[model samples]
Target chain A: MNSSSSGNVGIVIVSHSPKIAEGAADMVRQMVGNAVPLAWTGGDIDGGLGTNVAGILEAIETAWSPAGVAVLVDLGGAETNSEMAVEMLPEDRRARVVVCNAPVVEGAVIAATESSGGSPLAAVKRSAEEFYA
Target chain B: MHDAHASRPGETPVPLTASAVLVNKVGLHARPSIKLTQCAKGFTAKIELALAADGPWTDAKSPVKVMRVKAPQGATLHFRVAGPDGKAALAAVLALVHDGFGEV
Candidate 1:
């Protein structure tokens, strides 16, 4: 993980399938390069299809930045697990992270793009959420 | 070049237009579309893109919208840019496409 005090917001991608999470992260890396911090998690602890709360927590830490971290989840389980992961954090750290209601892949890519351009956490979340709006 | 003269009050700004081919091997797929959107957002211009010279333009600054264009290799991309920085925006976008999105 880079410095959490960095100016750029970080991103976390969660999905039921590891491939989906990895592919989305790949697209983000390709477009944004190393401009923003990014991490992703998917599949259950046993390597089957599912979302793992512990893994989600680890990913959030891996991508942490004081600017903020936007978590994009693919399915309901992923979202719920991401929320649980957030709840597991300390009070102040919890506020810096948000689980975005968005289409996971697109949202992550857009969130990362905005973050790469040095947009704040709120702006990054807004741009990614605009897809639903 | 475009007519960049200031418009009279209540007059609509003259939009600058240009065309470029999608010369990259994959055209405007996910990666290219993301690059295009990121590039478009860097400017203050309101930019839109269409498959032809007229009609059905999509916001170029939206990655999803641009990806939906699903343009293939050899496809021509038409652009309409309107703003104080429209000319520069159009130039940058055109240059990106002309360079095959740095993939050619």
Candidate 2:
């Protein structure tokens, strides 16, 4: 994982199950040393689309202390819900939001571990920069 | 450009690289792990995983690989792509991971 470390970067990871989110977070702490802010979401098995856009916005807003925040998600309903939450963010904060393309477990761990010294956004960017041409 | 609605034809894969960051407080578990594995299927790329030295890393596209790799909050993962649409595959994976899956 590689990218430019720019500003404060918080992170939100969504999944269809709460266990997945927790598991990813556990991995992240192992990697980056756990100085950054992180969150998680999981849909109910009943297909409740358990993602709370408003809650996410609130968490991002609160987490947006020094810099901004980035979001990562697994496939299925989580993707749709994540995209919707992005729209919910304020126009200005939108630029701060970054949606990565890595898997939930892998992405969370990388972002969490990489976000040190630099801004969370910067760390996240670094964690995500390798795919660019 | 390939049809957005139509699935792209399968072909030999190439290699690309992308990064994934964890944003959830709880971290990666069963539900998210499976979904991530499913997302990898969208691409024809061969995905491999590497953790941030202290964390777990495995095959990005395989559920079994994912299960083998175990990580918690604040971790980061490296995904190397090898397939037909390595670039696109890498991009998509990065986006999904960066977005935090819209979780709390």
Report the lDDT tens digits of candidate 2 across residue range A1-133.
Answer: 1222344367677777667766776665554444567666665545465665665565466446346666677775666767777788779877777777767776666555445444347546555433231
Instruction: Highest TM-score: give the candidate number.
Output: 1
Q: What docking grade applies to model 2?
A: incorrect
Which one is best on lDDT?
Answer: 1
Error of 2 at A112 (Å): 2.1
DockQ of each: 0.37, 0.03
lDDT (C-alpha) at residue A132 in model 1 = 90
Runs of candidate 1 exceeding 4 Å displacement = A1-6, A17-19, A43-49, A129-133, B1-13
TM-score (C-alpha, index-matched) for candidate 1:
0.81
Tens digits of per-residue lDDT for model 1, A1-133: 2324356898999999999999998877877677888899999999999999999999999898888899999988998899999999989999999988789988998898878767888888987898898
True-structure RMSD for candidate 2: 15.1
lDDT of 2 by residue, B1-104 (tens): 34532344554333466567777665565445545755676666676667764324476654445645665767786777776777777777777667664455
User: CAPRI band of model 1?
Assistant: acceptable
True contacts kept of each: 0.37, 0.00
